[model samples]
Target chain A: MRNSIITILKKELKRVFLDRKLAFAVFIMPGLTIAIIYSLMGGMIEKLDDDAHEHITVVQTINMPHDFRLAAEALYGTGMIIEENEPTEKDKAVQKVISGDSDVLLVFDENFIGDNREGLPGVTRYANSIKDFSIRGGYMADSVLESMRKNILSERLGGVDEATVFTINREDVAKTEEKAGKAISMLLPMLLTVFLFAGAMQVGMDTIAGEKERGTIATMLLTPVKRSHIAIGKMLSLAIVSLASCLSSLAGVLISLPFSNTMFGGGFNFSDLAYGVSDFLLLIVQMVAMALSFVSIICLISALAKNIKEAGGYIAPAYMVILVMSMSTMFMQPEGVWSYMLPIYGNILSIKNILMFKYTHTSGLISLASTILFASVLAWLMVRAFYSERIMKSS
Target chain B: MIEVKNISKTFKLSKKQRTLDGTKNKFKIAVENITFKAKPGEIYGLLGPNGAGKTTVLRCIATLIKPDKGSIIVDGSSVLEDSREVRSKLCLLTNELKVDPNFTAEYLFGFFGRLYGMNDSEILKRKKILFEEFGIDEFADVKTSDMSSGMKQKLSIAISLVHDPKVIIFDEPTNGLDVITARAVTDYLKKLRGEGKTVIISTHIMTVAEKLCDRIGLIIEGGIAAEGTLNELLEKTGAADLDDAFFSIYKKTRENVS
Candidate 1:
C-alpha cells in the first residue's frame, strides 16, 4: 500500500512540476505574490513611522504666558520642533493647523495665569485633522499642564527646599516598540495562511480539476489502482506542494527583512523576533496542521468540481473566507471564547498571540486539534467522492 | 476466461416538469439479462449502435460500474467479490484516450508498469520492447502534449498492455483513428489473440467486426438481438454480409416488439 501510494504521488508530482505552466503557477507566482504583499505592507508601515517622526512646526500665540512657552520648548525637544511664530489670533492659529502650515498651535487664554490659580489651565491645542498626531498632541499638552501645576504648588509651600514635589520619573515601558515588533512578527503567520491557502488551491484544483478537464482522470481511474488510493495519493501530493509553497513564501518574507528597516522606516527585523526552540517547534506543528487543513479542504472542493473552470468558481468563495479570517487578526485581538473555538480563526489568533509574546498552551493545542479534525473529515469526504459515480463517469 | 451471467442495469431519468407534474422518476434499462462467455485465446465481438448498451456492458466487465442484477466472473474471480483481482487480470481500453500532457511517453509507460507491481528492471525491459515494437522510442522523451492523436492512441494502447494481462477489452478503439492506424490496431488485436489472450471488442464497424471477431453478438436496445459465428449469423438472416445480417436482426426485433 505504501509503495502504491508513493507511486501515485510520484506520478502526481511529476505531472504538476514537469509542466512548465503548472510549475510557474504552483511555485513562482505564489512567491512573487507574497513578496509583493509583504513589500506593500512594509511600505505602509514605514510611511506611518515616518509620519510619526517628521518635523512639526508649532506656532504659539502671544497670549501664551512665559511658563507655558517654556514648557512647550522643553516638550518639543528632539521629537518635534516648535517654531514660535509672530503674534497670531485664535482664528489664525486654527487656520494654520488646518492648512498644514504647522503641526500644532498652542493657544493660551488671556486669563491663563489667573486660570492656573483657579485650577483650570485653559489651554487649547490646534492641529490638522489627522487622528494619531492629534491624539499625540493632546497627550503632550496635558503633560505640560500637569508639570506647571506641580511647580506652582512648590512655590506656595514657602520654598523650604521641597524635596522634588512632582518627581515624575517616566520609565521606558517599551510597549510601543513591542507592538511594532509584534506587527512584524504577525507577518509569517499571515503569509503562511495566504500561501498555504493559495498553494493548496493551485495544486489540488489543478490535480483533480485539470485532469477532469483534460479528460485524463478517467484514464487514471481505469488503472489497476483503487480509487481510494488515487485520491489519497493525489491529496498527499497536493499537501506536499502546498507545504513547499508555504516554505517559499516564508523564505521570500525572510529575504525581504534586511530591507524592511528601510522599507518600514524603523529598526524592525524578523530575526530579532525569533522564538526559542520550543516555540519554534510549536510553530512547525501549527504550520503542518495548517497545511493539512488547507490541502484537505481544497481536495474536497476539487472532487466536487467537474473541471478547472468549475474549480475556479468554487475556490473564489474559499479565498474570501480565508482572506476575511486572516485580515480579522489585524483589526481585533483574539480574546473572546468564540475566537478560540473556530478552526482557522484559532490558528491566526494563536499566531498573533505568539508574535506578541503572549503564549497560551490551551489555544495552540485546541487550534491544532481542530485543524486535524477538520482535515480528517475533509479527507474522508474526498476519499468517498472518488468512489462516487459522478467522478468516475464525468469524462 | 471471462463469464457474465444475467447482468442487468437501470438508470433513473427524472420526469419532465410540464406534463409529468408531480410524477416520480422512470428508469431506462441500459443492460438487461446479458450473458456471454469468452475462453482463453478467442475474440468476442459485441456489435451495437450508438446507445445499444455495448459500452455499458463492457464497463461492467471492467468493474468500472456494477450490474444491478448479475455477476461477472473473470479468470475464476467474481467481479463483485474480487474486483481488484479482476482489474489486475484485464485491461479495459476505452475510446477516450487522455494522457497527462506533462509526461513523456516513457514516463507514463514506466509509471503504469510500476502500478501493475512490476519491478524497475522488469519495467525497463518491457518499456524498451514495447517502445521498439510500437515505434514510440523516437518520441520516448517527448512530452505527450506535442504528440499527435494517432501517436497518443498508440501510446495508450501500449500503456494498457504494459502488464500483459490475460484478458483485454476494447470499446470502439478505432473510432477516431485514420485508416492506417486503425488497421495497425486491428492487427495488434489479432496478435494478442495469437498469444492466447481473450479479447473482447465493442464496435459498430461491420467490416472490422466481421474480419476480427471469431464470434459476434448483435445487441439492440438493451439486450442481445442475435449471437452466433459469422457464417451462422449470415445463414440465419439469409444475408450476404455482416452489415445486412445486423440490419435484419435489428428489424426483426423491432417489428416483433412493436
Candidate 2:
C-alpha cells in the first residue's frame, strides 16, 4: 500500500469509528432494526395461522344419515360442531349459512334415505369461500362425507383388504441437509444482497458527496496524495464497514429464524443445512466480492453527485435495479455459463447455487470474474471523477 | 517563488446557475490571462472585488483546479504536469476550504501531516509551534464543529501549514474573523514572509492591501488592471492614498472592459 493511501484510509476509518453515535447508527442499528421487524412480522403471521387452526365451526345439516356420525367423528377432528337437524326447511337452512349465522349447510338428497344401497345419493355442501370458518367447515364436511362413503364401500365389499385394488404410499426421500438447503435457497440470497447494498449505501454517500458539500474534499485535494489513492482509500474503508453491517444483519436474520419457524413450517435445526467449512468459506468469498462491487458503484455515484441528497437520488434507482435483479433469482434456476456473467444477478444466482449445493467452480469463477471486472470499471470511473470536474460541482 | 503565467479558466453554467447569475452566456470566464510572481521575503496581494477572479487564479495556482490555458510554476514545479510536486511545495488557506467538522484539531493536524509524509516527531514539533502561536492549544482536542468560527479558521491555517511549504497563498485571509483574530492572522503572515516565504493573498480591503502587502495587483473583470507598490500606485494614479488609487483604476478598468 502507498503511504498516502494508508493515511487516507486510516483517516476515513477514524471519521466513522471515533464518533460513538455514528458508529452505532452505521453498524449496529441496521441489523437491530431488521431483527425487531422480522420478529414482529413473524409473530403476526403465526398468530393468524394459529387463529385459523383453532377456530371451531358450526355445521347445519339436513337429512344427514345417523349411521355416518361415528365415521364423521373419526375423521373430522375437534374443530367442527354438527348441529342436530331440527326438521328445518331447506331454503331456511341455506339462508342460515349465507347470513354467516352457520358455518356450513349440508344437504343430503331425498334418495339417500340412510340406505343408499338401492341408489347412490348425492350430498351437496354450501358455504362461503371468503370466510375462514366457512372454508374450513366446507373442507371438513367434504372429508367426513367422503370417509363415510369409503367405509360403506369397504363394508359392502366385505373387507377393506378386498376393497382396495392397490395402495399408493408417499414419502420424502430428500436428506435433511437437502431439505434445509431448499428452504433457505428460496430467500437467503435476495435478503443478503439487499442487506449488503443497504450497508454499503449507509456510509458511502457521506464519504465523498458529503465532503464535497462541506468543502472538506477540496482541503484534502490540496494534499500531495494522488487522487486515485483517495478514491481507493474511501472505497476500501466503505467495503470493510459495509461488510460489518451486512454481517450484523445476517446475525439478526439468524437470530430471528427460530421465531419465524412457524411461518416456514417448524422442523429440523440449523444443523440440517450441513455445510462444511469449505462451503462457508466460499460463500464468504463470493459475498465479499459482491460487497466490493456494491462499494465501487456507490463510490462512483457519490463522486458524480454534488451533495449527499443528489447522491441519494442517483443511488436509489441503482438500489431498486439490484433489488429487482436479486428478486428475479427467486423464480429462476442457474441456467448456463452465460447466466453467470450478468453482474449482480449472476453473483446472487451463484450464491443461491451455493446454498442449494448446486455450485460448480466454473460457475463460481465466471460470477466472481464478472463481478471483479464490473467493480473495477466502476472504481476506475470513480477515480476519474475525482480527477475531473464532476466532483467539484457544488449547487 | 511562485509564478502564475497567462492562466485562464472558464466555468460552464447550469440553467439554475445561469438564472441565478442572470446571464445568458453558457460559460463564465473566471480568470483570463492572469499572470504574476511572488518572490521570497515579499508579500504579493491580489486586490479585487468579490467576483474579480481572485479566488479562481489562486485555486489554479494551488493545483486544486486546472486552468483552461497557461500554467503555474511553484518552486520550479509545473502545476499542470507536476501537480503533486507543486502541491508539496505550496500551501493554500481560503475561507471556502475547511477541515472535517467531526475531527478534532489535534487529529486533523496529525492526519494532514501524515498525508504530507511527515514523521510523528516532525508533526508534533510543528503542532507545538503552530498551535501555540494560533492559541489553538487550548482547544486542540475539540471538534471543529464545536469550536468558535475564529478558532476553526485559525486551525485551518495551522493545518494548511503542517508541511511548512515555501509558498503561502491565502484568499480573503481575514474573512469571517474578529478584529483580534484578524490581526493575529495578519501578524503570522508577516512572520512567515519574514522567514523568506513567498506569500500571496487576495483581498478587497484597501487598508489591508496598503499595510500588509509589499506589492499590489489590481484585478478587474478577470484581468489585471494595474500592478505596482502602494506608493507607485498613488504616484501613477495621481491620488493621495491607496483608496483613491483603487477607484481611479477601477473606473478606468470597468470602462475598458465594457
Candidate 3:
C-alpha cells in the first residue's frame, strides 16, 4: 500500500511539474495577472488623486460692498480664485455655477452694509452639490461672510471673545493598529476560504474526472495497487497542489501589498497586525486544513461524475455552497467552540480568531481537527467509489 | 492456470438506459452460470458478436467488476476473496484503458512496474526487455498525447507487461490497430503463451481466433454455445471455416438482442 501511494504520488507530481505549460498555467499565471492588474489600477488612481488636490475652486461673487470684498480676498486667496470686481448680475453669476465653469456664486442686496434697516442682510449661495470642488467652494464662501460678521460685532461690542460664543474642542480616541487588525480579521477569513477552494477546484476536477473520462484511471486500477492507496495518494497530492496554487496567487498579492493602499483607495497597512509566531503558525494550519477539506469535497463529487464536464456541472453548485459558508463568517462573530468545529467555516473562524487576537489553542486545534476529520470521511468515500464498478462506467 | 466457475452478472439499468434498450425490466443479465478454465501454455479465446458478454467475462477474471454469483480463481487466489493477489498475478489490457497522455512510455513503464512492487534495478531490467521486445524503445521519450494511435496502443501493451504476470488478459487486443501493430500484439501474446503463461482474450474477429487462440469458446446471448478446438468446431457445425461455424451456432441459439 505504501509503495502504491508513493508510485501514484510520484507520477501525479511529475504530470504537473514536468510539463512546462501545465506548471505555468496552474502555478504562475494567476499571481502574474493579479500583480499586473493591481499595478495598472493603482497608478491611475494615484494620478487622479494628485490632479484633484492641485485644483483651485473658482468663487464668483456679485453686488458685494468694497470693504467686504477686500476682507474675503484676504481670507481664502491660496485655494480660491475670488472674482468680486467682475460681473455683478445675480442670474449671470448663478449661470456660471450651473454650467460647471465657476464653482460657487454668492449674491447679496445692494445696501448690504447698512445694518439698521430691518434685520440682517440676505444673501444667496449657489453651487452644484454633486461636484466636490463646488461644494468646498461654497463652504469657504460661508466662512468668509461669518468672519466679517464676527469682526463687526467684536468692534461694536468691545470684545472678540464675547462675539465668538462658547468654544468647543474635538477629540478622537480610536486605536489605529487595532482598527487595522479588525479589518484584516473580518476580510481575510472569507477571502482565504474562497481562494483555497477556488485553487482546489481549478485542478481537482481535472485530476480525477478527467482521468476517468479518458479511461486512464482504469489503467491504474488494473495494477496490483490497493484501491484505498490510490484514493489517499490522489487526495494528498491534490491538497498539496491546491495549496501551491493558492500560495502562488497570494504571493502575487503580497508582492503588490505596498501599492494596495492606492490600488484599493484605502490607507491601512497589514504590517500593523501584531500577530506572534504562534498565531501565524496556527493560521497556516487552518489554511492547510481548509485546503484539504475543499479538495476532498471536490474529489468526492468528481468521483461520482463520469466525465470532467459532468464533474464541473456538479462542482459549480458545491462552489456556491462553500461561498455561502465562507461569506457567513463575514457577518457573524465566533459563537462558541462548537461553531469553531464545523468544517470549512470552522477553519475560517480559527483564522479570524488568530487575526483578531481572540484565539485559544484548544479551539484552534478543534477547528483543524474537525476539518481534517471531514476530509478523511470524504476520502474514505472516494476510496469506496474507486473500488466500485461505477467508477469504471464511462457512459 | 485460471478457473471461472458458474459466474453470473446482472446490471441495474437506469431509466434512460431502460428507455434506450426498450426494456421494461429494471435489470439486464449481462452473463449467466458460465464456467471455463484456462490452463498454462495455451491461449484461450472467447469468441462472440457484440453484446455476447465476452468483455464482461474478461472483466470478471480481471476483477474489474464482480459476478453477482459464482467465483473466479486466478492461480490459487479467488478474484473476490483475494483480489489483490489475483491482480498481482494477472494483467488486463483493453482498448478503452489507456496511458496518461502527459507522460512518456518509459516513465509510465517505470511507474506501473513500481506499483507492481518491483525495485528500481528490477524495473530497469524489465523495462529494457519489454521496451525492446515491442519496438517501444524508439518512442520511449514521446508523450502518449503526441504519439500515433498505433504507437499509443503499442506503449500500453508494453506497460501492461511490465510486471510479467503469470496470467495475461486482453480485450479486443487489435480492434483498432494497423496490420503491423496488430501483428506485433498477437505475436507477443503467442510469445507469452510459449513461456507457460495462462493467456485469455475476447474478440469478435474471426482471423484472430482462428490463427492465434489455441482453444476457442463460442458465446451467444451471455452463455456458452460451444467450446472446443477450431477443428472440433468445424466438425461440429459441419462447416468449412470459423465464419460459417459461428453463423451456424448463432442461428441456432440466438434470441432477443438484449
Candidate 4:
C-alpha cells in the first residue's frame, strides 16, 4: 500500500514539476505578481504623501504677534523658508489663498494684550478646502493658534493644572506590539485563507476530473492498487503541492508587507511583523491541515464531476462559498470555543490568533483536529466516488 | 481461461443522457445475458455494430464496470469478489482509456509498471521489448499529445501490456487506425495468442475478425445471436462469408424479437 501510494505521489509531483507552464502558474506567479503590484502601490502612496508635503504653503499676516511668529517658525522648520511669503496687504494674502497659491491665510487683531479676556480680538483664518494641502495647512495653523490661546489662559490663571479640567493619557499594553498584532491579525488570516484555497483549486480540480475528462482515469482505475490508496495518494500529493503553492503566495504577502502596509495605511515596520520560529511552525501545521481539508473537499467535487469542464463549474461555487466564509474573519469577531469547531473558519481564526500572539495551545489543537476530521470525512467521500461507476464512467 | 456467465448491465440514464439517446425510459440496457469464453492459445472476437453492447461485455470482463446480475471469473478469481487479484492477471485496452497527454510513452510505461509492482530492471526490460516492437523507441520521449493518433494508440498498447498479463481484453482494437498500424496491432494480438495467452477483442471490422479471430460471437441489441468458429457460423447461417453470416444472424435475431 505504501509503495503504491508513493508511486502515485511521485507521478503527480513529476507531472507538476516537469510541466514548466503549470509550475510557473502554481509555484511562482502568485508571489512574483503580488510583489510587483504591491511595490507599485507603495511607490504611488509615497509619491502622494511627498506631493502633499511639497505643495503646502503657509501665509502669515504682517502684524502677527512675535510669540506666535516664533512658534510658527519652529513648527514649519525648513518649510517656512520655502513657503513663507510677506503680503503687503491682508486682502492680497486672502486672495493668494483663494487663488491656490498659498495654502492658508492667517489674520490677527492688534489688541495689544488687553486684560479683558472676554472682549479680546480673535484670529481669523482662511484656506481653500478643495485643495487637500490647503486643508492640511489650515489644520496646522489652527493647532498653533489654539496652543497660544491655552498658554495665555494658563498665564492668566496662575498656571493652573490642566488635569484639573480635562486630560487624557493613554496606557496600552505594549503599544508597538499591539499595533503590529492588530494589523496582522485582521489582514493575514483573510489573505492566508484566500491563497490556500486558490492554490488547492489550481491543482485539485485537475487531479481526478482532468484525468476522467482526458480518459486517463480508466487506466488508473485498472491498476491493482486499492481505491483507498488512490484517494489518499492524490490527497496527500495535492495537499503538499498546494501547501507549497500557498506558501509562495504567503512569501509574496510577507515580502511585500512594507509596501502593502503603506497602501493600506497600516504603517507597520518590517520588524514588527516578526514571528518566532515556533510560531511559524505552528502556522505551518495549520497550513497543512487547511490544505488537506481544502483538497479533500475539492477532490470530492472533482471526482463527482463528469469531466474537467464540469469539475471547473462545480469548483467556482465552492471557491466563492469559501471566500465568503473566510471573509467572516474581517468583520466578525471570533466567537467562543464553537468557532474552533468550524472547518475553514477554525483554521482562519487559529491563524489570526497565532499572528496576534494570542492563541492558546488548546485552541490550536482543536482547530487542527477539526480540520483534519473534516478532511478525513471528505476524503472518505472521495474514495466512495472513486468506487462509484455511475460517477466515474458517467460520460 | 476467461468466463463471463450471464452477466447483464443496465445504466440509469440521466436526463441529459436520455435526451442524447432519445429515449423516454430512465434505464438503458447496455448488455443483457452476455456470456462468452476464451481459452488459452485462442483469439476470441466479439463482432457487433456500434452501440451493440460489445464494448459493454468487454468492460465487464475487464472489471471496469460491474454486471447488474451474474458474475465474471478470470483465471479462477471472481471479478466481483476478488477484483484486485483479477486485475493483476489481465490487461484491458479500450477507446475510453488513455494516457495523460503531457506524459511521454516512456513515463507512462514506467508509471504503470511501478503500479503493477515491477521493479526498475523488470520495467526497463519489458519497456525495451515493447517500445522496440511498437516502434515507440524512436519518439519514446515525445509527449503523447505531440504524437500522431496512430502513435498514441501504439503507445497505449505498449503501456497496457507493461506487466504482460496472461489475459488481454481489447475493445475495438483497430477501430480508427491507419492500415499499417492496424495490421501491426492485429499481428501483436496473434503473437500474444501464439504464446498461449488468452486474447479477447471486439471489432465490427469483418476483415479483422475473419483474419484474426479463432472463434467469433455475433452480438446485437445486448445479446449474442450466434457464437462459433467462422466456418461453423457460416455453415449455421448458410452464408458465403463471415460478413454474410453476421447479417443473416442479425436479421434472424431481429425477426425473433419482432
Write down the C-alpha DockQ for each prediction: 0.58, 0.76, 0.81, 0.75
Q: How accurate is candidate 3 locally (lDDT)?
A: 0.84
Report i-RMS for every model: 1.4, 1.4, 0.8, 0.8
CAPRI level of candidate 1: medium
Better of 1 and 4 by TM-score: 4
lDDT of 4 at B162: 94
**Can you write out model 2's per-residue Cα lDDT over A193-217, one digit (the tens) per residue?**
9989998898899999899888899
- i-RMSD of model 4 (Å, 1 decimal): 0.8
Per candidate, native contacts kept equal: 0.64, 0.87, 0.84, 0.84
- The runs of at least 3 residues in candidate 2 whose Cα sits more than 4 Å from the true structure, single-residue gaps closed, are A84-101, A112-124, A155-158, A161-163, A263-265
Which digits, one per residue and each the tens of the lDDT, describe model 1 over residues A53-168? Answer: 68454554546667765766677665555555545456776776676665567766567776345556566667665756655665676676677666666677756257364557
Docking class of 4: medium
- Candidate 1: stretches off by over 4 Å: A58-70, A77-185, A261-274, A326-367, B12-27, B256-258
For residues A192-292, could you state the per-residue lDDT of candidate 3 as single tens digits?
Answer: 77778877787788789999988898888878888889888888888888888878877877676666556433677777767789877888888889988
* Consecutive 10-residue window with the lowest summed lDDT within model 4 chain B: B93-102
Error of 4 at A313 (Å): 2.3
Q: Pick the candidate with the highest TM-score.
A: 2
TM-score of each: 0.85, 0.94, 0.87, 0.88
List TM-score (chain A only) for every prediction. 0.79, 0.90, 0.76, 0.78
Q: Ten-residue segment with the worst summed lDDT in candidate 2 chain A?
A: A110-119
